[model samples]
Target: MEMSSKLLEKAVSEMAHLPGIGRRTALRLVLHLLRQPQGQTESLADALLEFRTQIRQCKECHNISDAACCEICSSPKRDRSMVCVVEDIRDVMAIENTGHYRGLYHVLGGKISPMEGMGPHDLTIGSLVSKVKEGEIRELIFALSATMEGDTTNFYIYRQLEGLPVKLSTIARGIPVGDELEYADEVTLGRSIVQRIPFEGSLKG
Candidate 1:
């Protein structure tokens, strides 16, 4: 808990703020970095700084990218008509790892969690509605986590798209209830995507 150097203390403090990292782990990481060559540490700092400063959100799907549009959104090989709705970039990465889906994505940024003060306006739902309105998207696949918040967010979007011509579907419940898509194994996630069911059917019981 006590560091001999104030600089080391500061470094550990900042590192501990990262998700899943505790003060002990942060101190260990800081010590490891100190033991590394000076250039390597500098390179890491530079990379983090550049990533924080230069990363952009894809203009179409809100995925983190190096430019205005992400590679998936801009790729002609992707099926633009099939848009998979996910909670964030992590979910996109998870689905991409499965390699079962060739469709484009729309990152909702976050779910509607009242306890966390995350609502529809706090997310990219408006643009998603606009995309559906454009009629270019023929199918919308809900790939959100199986938690209550995820279902709430999905139902909200379903209501918004009522009467729209787009085919609505959700990933099959191959994933355990309340599990995050990002945490599911590639095979299960792939099967879920490949064997998706109609949204209306998922709502019944």
Candidate 2:
């Protein structure tokens, strides 16, 4: 691509670094921002800066939050005894949108993928085990993707909590194998949560 200006080229390069965004799309976005009023661009820049600087992970669940703990974790109405385990914040958002789960969530950050060099230690699994050992969480629901990596992560955590009194469960198989929970339709996802089965049954299927 021919760059007419160094500043534009830099902006496009930065924007293109984002996931799913190519050089052409980044250029279009940069050009759109340039076409906007200076104040509009400044506001956008300020918002992004503030978000990057101010965002914090929830102390309990590790979800994104402005404070030490996320709103869901802090809410009195949430079911503290039931914890839903997900891969990341995006999965948390998807589950929340379904409005079927009222329990607190524990974001693992990512699944155990040897190809990606992401192991159990690379995630927030230790904190989750601590939460379970604390004896407050009576039920642990595996809401991760249906991929092999997701299953491995769930099984690893299940073993970590061995001999614990907590009941183990997983989202129903309504979600197709290899499909991410975040990509499933709300109705299907909600049904899966509502019809969750025992982890032992999940192992058989």
Candidate 3:
């Protein structure tokens, strides 16, 4: 791609670095932004900067938040006894959109993947174990993707909770194996949550 301007080339390069965006799409976006009023571009830049600088992870669940705890974790209506474990904020958003789960969530940050060099220590697994050991969470629901790494992470956490008096469960197999929870349709995900089975069965499968 020959750039008429260095600034345009730089903008396209930066935009193309985003996931799922190619150089052409980035160039189109950059051109569109250039076509907009200067204040409009400034507002966009300001919003992005503010989000990058001001965003914080919820102290309780590790979900994205502006404060110490996320709104769901701080809410009185949420069922603190039931904690649903998920991969990241996108999974949290996906589950929240279903409106079927009124329980609290513990975001693991990511799954254990040896190829990616992301192990248990790289995630919030330790914090989750601490939350469970506090004896407040009675039921731990595994809502992670059905990938091998997801299973490994779940089993690792399950082992950590051995002898604890918490009931363990996983979302039903309505979600296809190797599929991410965030990609499942709301109805299917909701049903899976409602019909969750014992975590032991997941280990066997």
The segments of candidate 3 whose C-alpha lies over 4 angstroms from its true place after superposition are 175-205
- Every candidate's lDDT: 0.94, 0.93, 0.93
Q: What would the per-residue lDDT of candidate 3 be over residues 1-205, giving only the tens digit for each residue? A: 9998999999999999999999999999989988888999899899999999999999999999999999999999999999999999999999999888999999999999999999999999999999999999999999999789998999999999999999999886687778999999987798788977788876763
The candidate, 1 or 2, that scores higher on lDDT is 1
Clashing pairs in 3: none
Model 3: lowest-lDDT 10 consecutive positions:
196-205
Candidate 1, residues 5-45: lDDT per residue as tens digits? 99999999999999999999999999999899999989999
Error of 3 at 59 (Å): 0.8
Better of 1 and 3 by lDDT: 1
lDDT of 1 at 164: 98
TM agreement with the true structure for every prediction:
0.84, 0.83, 0.84
**Candidate 1 has what TM-score?**
0.84
**Model 3 C-alpha lDDT versus the unseen true structure:** 0.93
